[model samples]
Target: MSIKRPRTGGAWSWHQDYGYWYQNGCLYPDMASAFIAIDPNTKANGCMQVLRGSHKMGRIEHGRFGDQTGADPERVEPAARVMDLVYVELEPGDTLFFHSNTLHCSDQNTSESPRWSLLCCYNTKHNNPYKESHHPFYEPLEKLPDSAIKEMGSKLFEAKTDFWDPANDETVGTGKDQ
Candidate 1:
């Protein structure tokens, strides 16, 4: 659940989600995420960009880049020279399921329209963290019927949700072992 405001949203540096998550205590790279578009996502509006099959490259070196941690350009630039760069354009309601290790990023939004999206991340039960952190541990999720979405409607936004606060948290890092 993130919003990329038009003309204000900044670009995301190339990186793998697992490149950071592995440091969170997850022993395996068995995770996935579903990104659902809430608004039209276009290249002009900073739609996601992926390096096809880059997940097979495994995790690359990551370090602080501006306010975010990004993949080492020394490694990523060489790969990008030969990998296929895909701009993931999507319409409202479109969904993209991607591996956690996938190398992906986005450009700054230059369009007049916003690009909002909801990302539902899932970790395999076998890949549960060894220690509790910002990410949820292995807890069985209650299955919801498809119609449940329509039933919730606007009420979903009204419900109280616990969100991760990086300011008060130290869950994000390369870990003590790294």
Candidate 2:
């Protein structure tokens, strides 16, 4: 929900676009993707499947969008949906990292066992990425001590709207990969 920050549907998108793209258009350009399986992932249990480097496929026409592909009677890439996707079978502690543009989706839990996982996304920090009207955008984390806040590189954006009377803002981007 926080990935797109406050844009399109903005804070009003808790359950809507956050999970399914219920709205016609709201998804921001994807930056990174990660998923953690609470229960080990498997085809029998409906684990996630991804199309390797699909995100890098030169911006395939988004059928869901009002693009030319949107109204095509046949899918732009019907085979790509299943054939191009790679099934992910993971160990309990295993982690998979991939480019943000990777096309990925999961299967149904046909197995009797339950599955749990955390899908994390990383994005390029844009300067004032939020929609113009959605000012004071915030995605909060648990309270951090001042020392830790400095360590994390957050900076104070505003004292007027941020939750804490005194706020901490990290100037993100000093980390390793990014």
Candidate 3:
């Protein structure tokens, strides 16, 4: 499941882990995505929250702006943490849609539940992994449709995609197709 912020805010924001694709004006993903919950999420437990329209910020220099909640003190604006953030709560099967740049975070698990959530992102074949390290995870791009691509500046990413198998206990990285 996804998270959402209160209704009072600007249009959008941006980040590294997540961000608004300026190539595409809309924040809602052009590609398809899914949220999976291993356990229920609640306000008492750690739940996902999002800042509406926070993606439009266009990649803020997190350290230049000044943010302290970062897990890495030295790496300012590390990944998605560089963008604005909002906390979201969720229940099993309660899915929410967010734009690419939407700033979001998972709250602490105040409840007994594990609050597990699987965030799967997809794009067109034309779209490639933002980071070189992510290359091995995706299939090759060949005549990928526009609907399948999420535009980020000159870069492109697969939009219409699905995980062959998530690396969970049963699907451990044995190097075989899940």
Candidate 4:
């Protein structure tokens, strides 16, 4: 889940989900993510930007971009030059699914409305990591009904749950938790 506050959101450097997951020991590119728009996604609001068909290029080396781990510009620059750069504009409730290797990023929101989204990431059993880190190994998925969302809508995340904060993280650059 991500929340880009109106006019104050920060930019996300170009990156691939697999770039991060690979560090977690995932052996294959059998992963993906579903991005659901909770608020309107527009150009002015910093909608998601994707390099079309870039997933076919396979995984690229990743390194530090400010406090975040991002795709190395050496690769991203060339790919962006030849590929179609698509701005993913979506209305509320719209969902966009993409492969883990797809290069993507977003700019800071300059609109008055907030840009919020729910990101659901998935990993296949065949590509389970060799070692455990912050992410879990393969486990049986508990199917839930659509009504589950409304049922848990009012619930809040527990404060003690050790949420991952990239800004304070010291190991994302090294691909291991310290």
Candidate 5:
């Protein structure tokens, strides 16, 4: 999940999802993500940007960038010269799916409207990590009925799940919590 508050949101540096997953010991690049817009996404609100067809370029080197891991600028700058930079603007309920190696980032939200999106990531069983990592290995997904979702959205429903906090995570990448 990604969220950027109005006017005070921070920028996400250029990087590929594979760049981070590679560190987790995943053997293959068989992974992808679907970003579902929860609120209106526009350029003024710092919509996601991608280097079109960048997944073909393979994974780039990544290093710690403040509280996140980012692709090396030396490699990214040259790729940007050949690839098209596309700003992904979408309405609520819109979804954008991309390969793990796709280069992408988003700027700070300087507009009055908030920008929020939910990212559902997937990893193939063949791509499971050789060693244990922060993310889990191949686990069966539990399917819930449509009625379950309807009940969860109702005011009478009480939330039962706890959100994952990155602050408590002690990964080797960025020492500071975002």
Candidate 6:
């Protein structure tokens, strides 16, 4: 999950999460992510922007942009010129399910209110990584009822969460060899 704080939030360059994931050893691009809005998401607050149906274009070349990996602008620029741009504005509690290869980006937040969101990523069992990487290998997920969330309450946040240390991460910078 990630949060985009208002006024100080930075922009995400146009890129697909799978563009980098493919280099992480995933053989196929069969993955998805759920973006759950924790706060109102609006263009003024840097709501996600997507090129409609760009996933059909498949993964484009990705290269470094500072500490971030972004899609090649040479290819993205042509697509942006012909594709319809969609501003994914959402109300709190609204959820957006997107394919991993979907080309998406966001502008810097210029609103007074924050744009907080949680992104739950999922990978298909058949698309398991050939080797371990920054993401997890395929494992059967336990089914939980909707009420489980409310029942857990504050206890959920108390659980020890394993966070990725970028300094130790081999997924970025090293390219496919990682």
What are the models' TM-scores? 0.82, 0.49, 0.45, 0.81, 0.82, 0.82
Clashes of each: 0, 11, 35, 0, 0, 0
Model 5: per-residue lDDT, tens digit, 119-168?
99999988888886667778677899989877778567567645655654
Off by over 4 Å in 2: 1-30, 60-84, 127-178
lDDT of 1: 0.83
Instruction: Look at candidate 6 and tell me the lDDT of residue 62.
Output: 91
How do the residues 38-153 of candidate 2 rate in per-residue lDDT, one tens digit apiece?
56777776556666555544333333332111212243255365546678888776777765445454444546665666666554434224433222333555786778866757
Local accuracy of candidate 6 as per-residue lDDT tens digits, 110-145 = 888988889888888999889768777877879999
Model 5 poorest 10 in a row by lDDT: 169-178
Q: How many backbone clashes does candidate 4 have?
A: 0
Most accurate candidate by lDDT:
4
Candidate 3 local lDDT, residue 122: 63
User: How far off is residue 110 in model 3, in Å?
Assistant: 3.0
Tell me the deviation in Å of residue 70 in model 5.
0.4
- The TM-score obtained by model 1 is 0.82
Expressed as tens digits, the lDDT of each residue in 85-144 for candidate 4 is: 999999999999999999999988889999999999998888878976777667787999
Q: Any idea what lDDT model 5 has?
A: 0.85
Q: Model 4 Cα displacement at 167 (Å)? A: 6.4
Per-residue lDDT for 49 in model 6? 95
